[model samples]
Every structure is written in structure tokens, then in C-alpha cells.
Target: MSKRTTLQIATYGIVCLAILLVPSFMDDAFILNKYARYLVLGILALALSLSWGYAGILNLGQAASFGLGSYCMAMALKLRTVPVHTGKTGLPDFMVWNNVETLPWFWEPFYSLTFAIFAGVAVPVAFAMLLGSFIFRGRVTGVYVAIITLAALVVVNLLIIDQQRYSGGFNGITDLAQLELFGLTFDAYSSSSYYLIAISLTVCLFFALAVTKSKAGLILQAIRDHEERVRYFGYDVARFKTFAFAVSAGIAGVAGMLYTIVMEFASPTFLDVQLSLSVVIWCAVGGRQSLLGAALGAIIVTGMQGALSESEIFLESWTLIMGFVFVMIVLFLPKGLAGAIESLVDRIIPEDHAVQVKSRAAASRRGVENEAGSP
Candidate 1:
């Protein structure tokens, strides 16, 4: 491998090691739990990077899938806690208050933890496939895709808020039961929960990295750069785009479930437009072109937000300060922190070597295209 690739791998290894060592350094369960939420947000950033960075599909409503997953897990956990808090009806407190006579058929399936887990991921993937088929097959692109997604997210958010009888409504589902598996409970404030979030983030990071390095990933990038060219090359550009969209949704769904586990509840804010837009900013600030960079961007930005929000001096103006930081990054460091770091590394190392590497990669791509064009 080239020196650049080696350096990237080393950087990723260091990040993984740092994440694993966090719990060892921080003894406070509260701090660990807070950081766990940041890590879960990182996973969402990774999902956006996969779709926006690799596939060129800018989804403004990424929170829809996330909210779906959160509610699915929360439903199961809520059912687990319902009996303790409610009467013989076994309905969620909100439902009981709303005079729901019977457990909704839609919610009955979530009574099983196993089914809930499956639905948490599968529902988002299915939704993405359905949405993607329509959007991509219709040849939607650029800002139009963003608009459609943002609209969809708003619709879903409103629907959830309106269906207070079935859903938790604006209050959302609260007082969730801790996840139990293999006779061990995962408390939101416990080390086990932190480890769960950390491990899931690690697995997702590597899995996404592998996908970006695969042949399909290369084609997806090509489609992003030149959709017509890829189509002319006998590739189903829409299919590839849809597949990436579905995968992104699936990853976001996993992050949602993890979010529910760490937060101990599912809230309508999970599907908010503000949160979705913030996700896009996170990807932009982290270097969306790189999965690892995007994840780190989310974690770092979120950490800064928390620190600022908690500080008495910045408590009221943190949002303004964050907005300034984002503007500065966009004005000067358009490629983001990761891109800046890569540039600095290139300057410190040798540009000649990097140029040669890029040249060879270009030549290889040409050769592949030529082969495809031939009989």
C-alpha cells in the first residue's frame, strides 16, 4: 500500500483505540453516557456520508429513518414497562389516557424484543427502498432530492405528533425499560451501554469503510461524478443510487435504536428538521468524503455543543457561536478538518508520490472503462 493509505489506516486504528480506552479513563457514568450519545450521532453522520459523499444523494430528511427506528425500539421497551406503570389494559400510559380500548395492531408486533429489533432496521431500509425507487427512478437529482426528503421528514414528524393516541404524540414515548440480553441488562448510564454504542460505531465505521473501498463503491462514486457516463457504461445508475440510499437508511436506523437505548426514551425531536439539517452540517464539517472524518466531525461538533451549552458564559449564545464556526469552516476550509489534515500531511510528506498514485489510479479506471466498452 501507499504511504497515504498507510497513514489513513494508522489514523483509523488510533481512533478505534481511543474510543475503546474512553471508558477506562472516565469513571463517571454520566459523562460516559453523554459521550455515548455523541457516538450514536456519529453513526448518523456516517450514514449521511455514505449517501451524500459516495452516492451524491443529498437527503435532507435523514431523521425520518432514525425516528422510525427509535420509535420501534421504544415501543418494545415501553411495552416492557407498561404493565408496571399502567393497568390491566397493558397499554402505554398515553394510550390509556387517550382511552385506547385495545392495543393497536401495528404496535402488537413490537411486543417481542426480537421482532422490534428486526423492525428497527428493516422498516427504515424498506422505507428507503420505497422512497428511493420513486425518487431515483424518476431521475431526481441535486437540490430536488433534498427538498423531497426534507418534505418527507416533515410529513412523518407531523404525523407522529398528530397521532398522540397511538404514538406518544408530542410528548413521545418515555420511561423505557432497559435492554436485556443474555441475562444482562443495559442501563443507559452503565458502562455496558457505553460499550454497546462504542462497539456498534466501530463495527459500522469499518463496515462502511469496506463498502467504500469495494468495486461497487467505486462505481457509486463514478455515478455521483457523472451519472450519464455511468449509464452509458451499461451500469444501472438508479439501482446503485437506490441501493446506497437504502444502506444509508439502514445505518441511520441502527443509530436510532442505539439512541433510544442510551437516551432511555424516544422523542419527536428525533425526527425534527433542525436535527436533520444539523446532520448535514456535521457531515460537511467533518469531511463528508471520508466516512471516518464524518463520524469524528459529528462527535467533535456535538461535544463542543454540549460543552458550550453547559457553560454559564455561553449558555444562551452557543448556537450563534456554532453558526459562526460553521461559516468560518465553509469560507476557509471548504473540504473540512479531514481535508485540511490530509493537505497538511501531503505538504509534510511528498507531493510527487501522491501524484504518481493518483495517476496510476486514473489509468486503472480508464483501463476498466475500456474493457467494459469492448466486447
Candidate 2:
């Protein structure tokens, strides 16, 4: 393999290794849970990178897909804990509190764990497909796409918050039981749960890497660079955009599902506009062009936020500080932190090796002994 490809492989391998060894270095359940949360958020940022950076489709409603996934798992877990004593898996407590005498037809499907798991992923992908059909088919691009997505996110958020009986309203779906697979219950704060998240992150990152290195990824980048030219070349630009949107939504949904399990609840905050914007910022600051960069950026940014917010002095000013940081990153490091690192590494470790010698004779001898001088 080429040196560049070998270096990339090594980078990914090292990241996976770090994820695997992190729990050993820090065993506290609270801290590990926080890191798991960061990883989950990283997956969401990576999702946006696929859609925005590669396909050139900026979606601001990504949280809508995330909420859908959270609700999918939340509904199932909620059902598990409901009173079956009535000879029926009764409605969630929030519903009954709102005088919901009978379970909703849609909620019935979630009673089955298999269906819930499937829907957690498929629901968001289907949603993206439907939205992309309308948006991309109509030739929406650039900031228009972002505006439309942001509008959709608001609509969905309002819908969930207003429908108190079915959705738990502003409180969202909560008090969920643990996820059961193969008769095993996964604990939110346990090591096993952290490992599950780490494995999932690794798998998702590798999958994204594979996608970005494929022929389709190249075409997607081309479309991002020149959509009109791509369309003129007879490629179904809309189809590819829709596919990227769907994949991004699916990954974001996975992040939502993981968040619900780790946090032990799903809230309306998952679908909030602020969160969607924050995710965009994370991608921007991490170098949205690279999947690994975006994911790593998410983790680092979230970690810093947490640490900074905990400080008594910075608690009130963290948001302002964050805004300044974003501006500076945009102005100076336009490619974001990962992109900057990549450039720096490239400079420090030149693609072509450089040889230096203590003396002119030594340098001349080395040059004569080199491949170019070999006979």
C-alpha cells in the first residue's frame, strides 16, 4: 500500500486502540458515562460531516432524526416498565397521567423489542428519504437547505412538545427501563455499557471511512464542488444527496438511541434548535471534510465545554468564550482543528523524506548511496 494510505490506517487503528484502553485508565462510572456521552455526540457530528462536507447538503434538522430514534427506544423501554398487571402493556405513565385510557396504536409496535430496535434506525432513514425527496428534488441547495431543515426541526420539536398525552410534552419520554438483549440487561453506568458504546463508535467510524474512500464518496465530493456539472454529466444528483441524508440520519438516530440508554431518558432537548446548531459548530470546528476529524472534534469540544462549565468563574461566561473560539477557528483555522493537525503533521513529517548530514562529504556520500545514485 501507498505511504499515505498506510498512515491513515495507522491513525484509525490508534484511535480505536485509545477508545478500547480509555476505560482502563479511568474507571469511575460517572466519568466513563460522560465520555460515552461525548462519543455518542461525536457520532452525530460525524453524521453531519457526511451530509454537509461530502454531499454539500447542510441539514439543520438532524436533531429531528435523533429525537425519533430516542423516542423509538424510549417507547419500548417505557412499555417494558408499564403495568402489565392489567393483562395489557399499558400506556406510558405520562400518557395515563394525561388521562390516556388506551394505548396508542403506534405505541403497540414498540412493545416488541425487535421492532423497536429496527425502527430506531429505519425510522430516521425513512424520514430523511421523505424530506430529501421534497428538498433535493425541488433543487434546494446551500443556505436554503439549512433554512428548510432548521424550519423542519422547529416544527417537529413543537409537535412533540405540544402533544403532551402521547409524547410526554416538554418533559419528553423518560423513566425508561434498561435495554434487554438476549435476556441480558445493560446498565447505564457499568463498564459493559461503556464498551458497547466504544464498539459502536468504532464500527460507525470505520463504516464512514469506508464510505468516504469509495467511488461514491468521490462522486459525492464532486457534486459538492459542482452540482450543476455533476447533474449535466448525467448523474442523479438528487438520489445521491438523498442517500447521504438518509445515511447521516441513520447514524444520528443511533446516537440518539445511545444517548437515551446512557442518560436513562429522552428529552425534548434532543430535538432542540440550539443542539442542531451546536452540532453544526462542532463539525465546523473539527474540519467537516474529514469524518474522523469531525468525530474527534465533537469529543474534544464537548469535553472542554464540560470542564469549562464546571469552573465557578467560567460557568457564566462559557457560552461567550465558546462564541469567540468559534470565530477564531473560522477566521484562522478555516479547516478546523483536525484539518490543521493534518496539515501540520504533513509538514513535520514530509511525504518525501529529507536527509541531513554532519558534513558536505557525508552529505555527498549519502546522496551517492541513495536510490537515485544506485546502479
Candidate 3:
């Protein structure tokens, strides 16, 4: 491998090992859980960065996909805890509280862990495909796509809140029991769970990197920069966009599944527009073009919130501070924090002496006429 590639691989290996091993050494479950949650959020942010940054598709409904996956997992766990009924059964607790007399048929499949996993991924990708087909084929662009996605979040949230019969309204599905992989029990509070999440995050990062570096990745970037040119080149732009959107939604779904497994709850608030926007902010702050940047942004933002919320002063106005910081980054460090770091590194690392000598020679030649006037 080239030196850069080898260096990158080495760096990644060291980082993964550190992330995995460090938590095992920590005695505090709370601290581990907090970081684990941050990592989960980072996974979603990384997915967003890949889809929106690399593909030039802004998905404002990412949280909807995430929420769907989470709720599916929670529902599956809830079903496993309840007794199976041959006929009609009462609704899930929140649904019963909402005055529903019967459980919805659609919810029955969730009783099986396998089926729940299927629905968790399938539902989000299906939604994304349907939504993408309509939007991309219709040639939606700029803020229109954003508006449509925001509307989707609002509509989905409202539907969940109103269904009351099927979906646990307002409250959403919660108290979701811990997951089990085959015969082994998965405890969210243990250091092992933290290791699992860390491993999962690493795997997801690899997958995203692979996808972003593949042939399809190049085509997606082309579509982003010049949709019309790609269309004229005999590619179906809409179809590609739809495919990309589906893949993005699927990744978000996985993150949501992990979120529920870790958080042990699902709520309508999880699909809020603000959550969606916050992800975009994470991408923007971390350098949208870099998946690592997106993850870093999520970690930093979550960490900042935790730190600021605990502070006595400016606790209530943390959002304002975050907003100001975002604006400054956008205006001055357009490439985000990751980009800034790269820029700084490049500046600090001096060029070869030969290159420096050539640069000075070229400069002197350009100013040759001024030499006679220098006296």
C-alpha cells in the first residue's frame, strides 16, 4: 500500500483498539453508557455525512428512519415479554392508555425477533425508496427536498401520536427489555455492551468508507455535482438518487436499532425535526465530506451539551452558544473542524527544501524588474 494508505490503516487500527480497550478499564457504568450513546449518535452522523456530504443529498428526515428502527426493536422486545394470544389481544400499554380495544394486525409480526429486524430495516428503506422516487423523479432540489423531509418527520410523528391504537402514541414504545443474541443475553449497562457498540460503530464506519469509495460512490458524487450531465451521459439520475437514499435510510435504521438497544426506550420525540437538523449541524461542523468528521462532530456536540448543561452559568442558553459556534465555523472554517485540523497540519509540516528553493526562485523571477529600483 502507499504510505498514506498504510498510515491511515495504522491510525484506524490504533484508534479502534483504544476505543474498545479504554472503556473496559473504566469502573463507572454511567460514564461508559454516556460515551456509548455518543458513539451511537456518531454512527448516525457518519451515515448522514456519507449520504448528504458525498452524495449531495440533504436528508432532513433521517431521524424518522432512525426512530422507525428504534420503535421496531422496542416493539419486538415488548411482544416477547407479553403472552401470545390466539385471537384479538389488548393494545400495547400506551395504546391501551389511549383507549384502544384491540391490537393492530400489523404489529403481530414484530413478535418474532427475526421479523422485527427485517421490519426495522425494510420499513425505513421502503419509506426512503418511495419518498426518493417521488422527490428525485419529480426533480426536487435545494430547500424543496428539505421541506418535504421536514414534512415527513412532522407527519410521521403526528400519525404515531394519533394512531394510539397501533403505535404507542406520544409516549412511544419504551421500557424495551435488553436484547439477546441467540442464547446469550445482552446487558446494556455492562462494559461488554459498550464494547459491542464500539465494535458495531467500527464495522459501520468500515462499511460506510467502503461504500463511499466504490464505483457507485463516484457516480453518486458525479450526480451530486452535475445531475444533468450524468443524465445526459446515459445514467438514470433519479434511480441512482433513489438507491443512494435507500442505502442512507438503511444505515440510519441500523443506528436507530442500536439506539433503542442502548437507550432502552423509544419516543415520538426521537423523530423531531430538531433532531434531524441537529444531525445536519453535526455533519456541517465536522466537515460534511468526511465520515470521520461527522462522527467527531456528533461526539463533540454531545460532549459539549453534557459539559455545558452541568455548568452553573449559561446552562439554559447552551443552544445559543452552540448556534454561535456553528455560525463561526461556517463562516471561517468552511471545511469544519476536521478540515481545519488538516489545514493546520499541512501548514505546520514544511515542504521539501527543493520545493521551497524552487518557490523562492519563481518569486524572484516575478519581481525581477524591482531589483533595479531596490537601491
Best-to-worst order by TM-score is 1, 2, 3
TM-score of each: 0.92, 0.90, 0.87
Clashing pairs in 2: none
lDDT for model 2 comes to 0.87
CA deviation > 4 Å runs, candidate 3 = 1-5, 82-91, 345-375
> Model 1 over residues 141-184: C-alpha lDDT tens digits?
98899999999999999999999999989999998889997788
Report per-prediction Cα RMSD to one decimal: 4.9, 9.2, 7.4
TM-score, cand. 3 vs. native:
0.87
The sequence of per-residue lDDT tens digits that candidate 3 reaches over residues 1-375 is 544446556665676677788675796988888888888888889888887888888988889998888888889887655433322333456665656665577887877899898888899999999999999999997679888988988898889888766777777786566788777666777786787788978888778777877888889888876677888899888888888888888888888888887788888887888899999999899888878888889989988988888898979999889989999999998879888876675567655668768867865864684476467
Model 3: which residue pairs collide? none
Ten-residue region with minimum lDDT total, candidate 1: 82-91
Q: Which candidate is the best by lDDT?
A: 1
Which candidate ranks first by TM-score, i.e. highest? 1
Show how many residue pairs clash in every candidate, following the order shown: 0, 0, 0
**66-94 per-residue lDDT for model 2 (tens digits):** 88998898988888885544435666778
What's the lDDT for all of these models?
A: 0.91, 0.87, 0.81
Question: Poorest 10 consecutive residues of model 3 by lDDT?
Answer: 82-91
